[model samples]
Target: MADLSKDYMSNSADPKNIQDLTTFVQNLMQQMQDKFQQMSDQIITRIDDMGNRIDDLEKNIADLMTQAGVDEHV
Candidate 1:
């Protein structure tokens, strides 16, 4: 039977493998952060759009009230 300890020892002593693993983890974390930021930006944009639409609707209602001679302050 072939011994496997030597293989494990050799792999553990290699710094290149560790560096590669570290780089991979860093890239993954960066991608996750970027995606989170993109989603947050989208949510903020939607909220802003909804606010603008609500404002327009309120203005339209006020205009309608004025046309009908309805008192808006009542």
Candidate 2:
């Protein structure tokens, strides 16, 4: 196994090496951000689905109670 950390970090100040490291970090951050956005979108969609189901259930219960002629006092 090669130790990437050891090879990337050097005492010498090489411009090319610094640029390569910076590019690599930038790419990694972009990938992470994209995945986070995807996860957030999925969560929001699921929540919306749940809310729709709850709304349907509420409507069904109200309809049933009205059909049965149940009063709030009773």
Candidate 3:
């Protein structure tokens, strides 16, 4: 992996400047990570919702088949 800290520090030679740059990059990365996690959670919730919908549809189909007298033995 690339040395992200060094790269983000703009190759600063001064110790204090490098430290400030490092902090800035770290905070920015943390914010991005939080946003990504939120998005992932939302996607998972949506997938679970879709799965529930599919289960309901399956039950409806089974009920319809029963009412139509489709052979249960099959």
Candidate 4:
């Protein structure tokens, strides 16, 4: 069989091929970063919404306690 390594080296030596490979890698990295950023944003939004819901629940519970004439410090 012919020297496959030599053939690969020759093909890889072409500047256009190198540029194309670099561009492909950069684009792939950017896509992955974008996906990660989107996921992070969604996680943060969900956490904030959960915090709001917890706060509302706490407020409602406090209101119920007051209606029953219970002291808050008790």
Best prediction by lDDT: 4
| lDDT of each residue in 36-72, candidate 1, tens digit only | 9999999999999999999999999999999999999
lDDT of 4 at 70: 97
Model 3 steric clash pairs = none
lDDT per residue as tens, model 4, 1-74: 37998888899999999999999999999999999999999999999999999999999999999999999999
Which of candidates 1 and 2 reaches a greater lDDT? Answer: 1
Model 2, range 3-74, lDDT digits (tens) per residue? 666665552357877788899999999999999999999999999999999999988988888899986456
Candidate 3, residue 28: CA error in Å?
1.1
Candidate 3, 1-74: lDDT as tens digits: 36888786665767888899899999999999999999999999999999999999989988989999997668
All candidates: TM-score: 0.84, 0.76, 0.73, 0.89
Clashing pairs in 2: none
In model 3, which regions exceed 4 Å deviation?
Answer: 1-12, 72-74
The 10-residue segment with the lowest total lDDT in model 4:
1-10
Which sequence of candidate numbers ranks them by TM-score, best first? Answer: 4, 1, 2, 3
Residue 17's lDDT within candidate 4 is 99
Collision pairs in model 4: none
Worst 10 residues of 1 by lDDT: 1-10
Judging by lDDT, tell me the better candidate of 1 and 4: 4
What lDDT is obtained when candidate 3 is compared to the true structure? 0.91
lDDT of each: 0.94, 0.86, 0.91, 0.97
Model 1 earns a TM-score of 0.84
